[model samples]
Target: MTCKSSTTPVMGIHLHDIHSMASKLETLTKNQQLDQNDIKSILIVIDLNPEPMSIDDELESSKLTRKEFAKSIKKLAELKLIDWDFNW
Candidate 1:
């Protein structure tokens, strides 16, 4: 995303920009209508710097409750939409 706005950071990106991108990703990840929050959560887990993301980390990184996150992850896995290994 090339921003011509004066508020744009000279280098790197603003944290708010990342959140905005995630919001956009909610509707842009697929052609079909899927659970937006679930998709966003999965993207967060996958986009993070390191592999083997922990359950606790996912909970902490997201606004979702443990149960909610687990449910989404499980659903995505069952649909074969995602298959990354994370710490339990």
Candidate 2:
């Protein structure tokens, strides 16, 4: 699916993006000794949105419970993988 933008044609996250992110995460997981839950959480966030999502928005979009979402967000933050913008 393509994103609807007036001037420029923006491409939404695709299968390739997901695969690439997963592969990278897999390597990170092995190196960091991340648990399955952590990996799944990261994958969920990546699959849902490419840009930085508000905590509420991400929780709404993902299948994770509130606690799980919070935990995942904390993990992502700790890894410096996400750029948090409260203003967004």
Candidate 3:
């Protein structure tokens, strides 16, 4: 994803850039009730799996409980950050 700043437009964001941005955002929002682990898990899943992953597979890989994973996924979806389809 390319981000446009006031000065210039960033073109072609890579995975590393996304991770860095997320980390910086997390640090900037210290008082926010955001779960760093959940963000990390989502990034890891995106990095590790090029294809769409099942909910169970993502939960197992991220080591998050069903509830936690579901919550995170819902939040991510609400933010329009991830495009996921529930086949099951």
Candidate 4:
């Protein structure tokens, strides 16, 4: 159950170099160019996906509280980074 990477799991696939991904995400946020809704939605996908992350795990890896993480996911979903249906 160890992903050994930082990118959130998707469809049981663990993206490599999670740290870099996170950095890019941070940059996106800093630029204020990313859609807030999209951020929330992406967080939602990460939260609801079948990955084995606990709230504590998320805190440890993503430095976000459970509530904050949930909120962020909602934003991502709105942006369409993640779909509600399991199509992709």
lDDT, candidate 1, residue 75?
46
**Model 1 per-residue lDDT at 47:** 32
Which candidate would rank higher by TM-score, 1 or 2? 1
Q: What is the lDDT of residue 64 in candidate 2?
A: 48
Between candidates 1 and 2, which one is better according to lDDT? Answer: 2
Global Cα RMSD, each model: 11.5, 10.4, 9.3, 9.2
Alpha-carbon local distance difference test for all models: 0.42, 0.45, 0.44, 0.42
Q: How does model 2 fare in lDDT? A: 0.45
- How well does each candidate superpose onto the true structure, as a TM-score? 0.34, 0.32, 0.34, 0.35
- Of candidates 4 and 3, the better by lDDT: 3
Tens digits of per-residue lDDT, candidate 4, 8-56, equal 5333322222333444565776788667553443342232344486436
Reference-based lDDT, residue 4, model 1: 24
Candidate 1 lDDT tens digits, 1-88:
1212122223333323334444444455454555646443333223333347543564466555655544544544454445535444
User: Which residue pairs does candidate 1 place in steric collision?
Assistant: none
The pairs that clash in candidate 3 are none
Q: Rank order by lDDT, top first?
A: 2, 3, 1, 4
| Candidate 4: stretches off by over 4 Å | 1-53, 84-88
Judge candidate 3 against the unseen true structure and give its global Cα lDDT, from 0 to 1: 0.44
Model 3 off-target regions past 4 Å? 1-58
